[model samples]
Target: MNTILIIANLLVLFTFIIHTFGGDKNLKAIEPEQDSPKRLRIFWTMSRGAFHIVSIDFLFATIGLALINFTDYFQESKLLLNLLALYFLGYGIAFLLTLIISKKFSNIYFKMWQWLLMLVIAGLIYWGNS
Candidate 1:
């Protein structure tokens, strides 16, 4: 059994839970008012859709990791594991680049700590595949 992969799977599962439930309040806050312009409303709708799509992605990743760790189904699929790792690494890089471009260094770590979790998860996945 790949212990590192198992841990990564657990983390991904936890991330999915938090992102789905814990982010609800924040998501609601961004909702456009009924009286808002059509473009604003449309943007909000698209944003919300994108947000939920990420949650779904995380859910799928969690399931994928679980299958890889607990079953022989994906045991030999190193390329799949690498793809997952790259996906997460890209997410982390996106967050980091956003933070850098924002020029808000006051609270560097707390500003976008999600990047750290993403990078760690990516590293664990890659390491486990090896």
Candidate 2:
């Protein structure tokens, strides 16, 4: 469990760094069309990848919290955990589809909404683990 928490934190931190710093120069260079098919696909793929990576942390955090909240209700938490896990699975699918087909959602760390969500999820992860 400790290992899982640490891994989650690392992933979140790494993602934050990349999302924050990785594309600044590029963003300035590219005058992306907001609604173009190519741009939209790139946006989706990027957003999806970021989402699932953060979801890993959320998944672990929720599991950790569920464990702490109700030790005897492990079975119940298992269902919740399984559901969260499935979201991550679906995230991967959507992410990959965007990468392969749409090419817009790829590496999506642009929108302020997504960045804020990542931060919120990180906080949730910390609370869940703690």
Candidate 3:
């Protein structure tokens, strides 16, 4: 589990580094329907939306350290690891909720992709841990 967490954190960091550097975003595909300002706004929103996942992922990865450190802090600490699991579950819920309720990001392809990917990630993590 310690190794799992270290790897997960590393993966999150890698993802953030990739996005922060503007790597491989499919920006050319989305088109504005009518108003140029609206188009610009959507483009901006989509562009920024990609970074939020990295931020959240990095945060969770930081928390994953508790799985390692907590055992030393308190002997026989399985609950700390359990909290990490709940963190993932809660994060997933938050992502799903944002996906459903964020009207500002509506009609944006990036948000849709973010929402779907988060849910999928949540499921995979849950299943993998279970």
Candidate 4:
């Protein structure tokens, strides 16, 4: 269970690193047409803001999971681990509710991946406590 959590955290860390470093390039690939400069600026700001939130959250999760697994290496904070789990569960539920209400997604693949991630976090938190 610990190993699983470690692996999950590593994957999330990798994802955050990719998004934080390659945000511009990745966003460029999916850039949508805008009618005016103002619209484009708004779109970019929203996109980057979203990316920043996800990246920062994942960064915290990665660190928290790492500390949970290797308590001696870093200051282990049960509160942090619990908070991370709650964050995962909340985001997962939010995603599910959003899909249920709208039946639409900016990226279906990412949504599915998030579900898997939520499950892993849930598993880790449940088993870690037991």
Q: Per-residue lDDT of 1-130 in model 1, one digit per residue for the tens? A: 9899999999999999998888766878888899999999999888878888999999999999987877778746799899999999998999888888886767886866999999999999999999
Clashes of each: 0, 16, 0, 0
lDDT of 2 by residue, 18-127 (tens): 55456444454553566768866687668656645664555455555445344655655545544444444554455445445644553554432343444444444444
Q: Per-residue alpha-carbon lDDT of model 4 for 19-122, expressed as tens digits?
A: 57787577777676665577787888798788788888878778777777777655545566666667777877776666667666677647556666665666
Model 3: C-alpha RMSD to truth?
Answer: 7.0
Root-mean-square deviation of every model = 1.6, 10.3, 7.0, 3.7
Q: What is the C-alpha lDDT of each candidate?
A: 0.90, 0.50, 0.53, 0.69
Q: Indicate whether candidate 2 or candidate 4 has the larger TM-score.
A: 4
Best-to-worst order by TM-score is 1, 4, 3, 2
Query: Over all chains combined, what TM-score does candidate 3 have?
Result: 0.42
Off by over 4 Å in 1: 103-105
Could you give the candidate ranking by lDDT, starting with the highest? 1, 4, 3, 2
For 12-35, candidate 3 gives per-residue lDDT tens digits of 455455544544354333544456
By TM-score, the best candidate is 1
Model 2 backbone overlap count: 16
Better of 2 and 4 by lDDT: 4
